[model samples]
Target: MSYRSWCLALGLCLINGPLLAIERAWPITEGMDVVGELSHAEAAYEDTLIDVARRHQVGFEAIRRANPEVNTWIPGEGTRILLPHKFILPDARRQDIVVNLPEMRLYYFPRDESRVMSYPVSIGRMDWGTPVGTLDVIEKRENPSWTPPDSVRKAYAERGEELPRVVPPGPDNPMGDYAIRLSRPSYLIHGTNWSTGIGMRSTHGCIRMDNDDIGELYSRVSLGTSVNIVNQPIKVGWRKGLLYLEAHPPLEELEDDAKGMDEAVAKVMDAVGERDARVDWSRVRSALNEVSGVPQVVGWEADQPLTTSTSATSSARAEPPAADP
Candidate 1:
């Protein structure tokens, strides 16, 4: 049967939501069809991307995939992201949507749900920040229009080039070929004129998925599907008897915050009183430097340093974007 026909046969259409727990590395089974989870939310923060992911217990890749449109290095102030803390696998015949804010990525759980596929994304920028709230897919379009927002028009007007109200869909169109309008006006899940900006922060206030990925998602989801937007900054886990932390601070935390990143790392270490712990200072420092917010750990640690693990029981899974020093 054809793809659409198959969907019709099952009466199962994919949907999006505001925030829902995401499944981790779930085992792919033949009979199980997993959709996005139904329970998860992002935290409010003004820190950088790395610090935000660390605090939220999610992977950097997951974050990147959820917010594909964000700039990786310079996310502006008050930018929010989705944190997948739990997994909601489908049961043999369902589909779901997953967005990880820190990594700025999105994953689509297909109807058959044999396996999950992820795509790079872009999210809100400094002034034209995206909102964090519950949303639904209200409409989907092919060859969508690129109506320039008034703010964008004003920007152009200042430059002596007054632009038209809309740009037609094509190579020059910012919306690319497909657009999924959200319940939130002026916001959408659409294609991009800027592709490298995928997996980074670069949009005014929309969830920018990859050209192909958005197309795949657009085809699967119907109007009125849920869409959840959020912001989280930290993700932690235990690996090999070590406590690992991954962080992505919000942009606001970097612009005006007075506390130095080095000092912040030292402070967190001091708080644990594990001064002698074998913490990777370089990793901590880089996260603070590159991500523009707080720092988080990506490996295990104790109040006291211990010998390296000798058994697999102590093994821990590293976050996808774990910075290697």
Candidate 2:
């Protein structure tokens, strides 16, 4: 089948209402690394990309990249905003919480181990990159105050602005209402009243989530919960008999270290392991080129008829360009 046809077969269709985002816990299957379904909805008159993103539990960059034709500031009425809700699970331990920096997304696996919850997040910018590794949640705080670090205060000072020594819990406090403190005091996976940064690299070495998401997660987690953050831009996984590849634009600083097709091809090889399958190199390259963060089929079992994956840009339901990003 053609790539577009495969997506239709996969039923990466439209969805509506409060039923979006990480509120849905995807069922986990043994070796089934792909989860969630691709969805897009028409923008209401007052909607901007970020507004639509927040409503659908998607990040700014993810939504923008997926719908390059839509306006970021004002996607005029009826414009279809593609929500990159589908994901290729990061290659990390599937327990506790896992934050994938490149995609600016987090996956939480509760003790039940039968399903996973996904959320969009904002990570530290290039200079103060969020470090990777396994860390445990050491504490939880509600209505936390924000004490500007010297570096942060110095930044405001250099810009000829004054920052109060401490910002009390309130709307102005960017720390949001709840914070999941990590083993290291310097780090936190916290909620943010500032939803603008939820899906971008715009933090000070901390992980930020939508206020609502973190609020719910806070109650579900306790001290000593393991949190593993990884930076995997290219993820490969299997579903049924096909091999899928999902790519995200690599962190700017790490782009120079990437080997392009060679790296992606190798990752597929590692994932395929001893299993017999045939891969479509061209499709793999196309997926890499788009860096959609939405998984697409790249291979199938050697004995099964191959269905080439197409980097479907949702052009069939093309939303007219309204504003530029």
Best-matching candidate per lDDT: 2
Q: In candidate 2, what residue range of length 10 has the lowest lDDT sum? A: 315-324
lDDT against true structure, model 2? 0.80
Q: What are the per-residue Cα lDDT tens digits for candidate 2 across 1-325?
A: 9653454355332222353434458999898988888877888765566767877778888988888778776688898777787888888878899998889999999986789998889999998889888999998999999898899899889999999999999998888999888987889988886675578888888999888889889999988999998878899998777778988898988778666677787788888787766666767778899987778787666666533342333311111122324
Count clashing residue pairs per candidate.
Answer: 91, 0
Q: What is the C-alpha lDDT of each candidate?
A: 0.53, 0.80
Q: Candidate 2 has which clashing residue pairs, if any?
A: none
Estimated TM-score per prediction? 0.52, 0.86
- Candidate 1: where are CA atoms >4 Å away? 1-95, 110-115, 237-244, 253-325
Model 2 misplaced regions, further than 4 Å: 1-23, 305-325
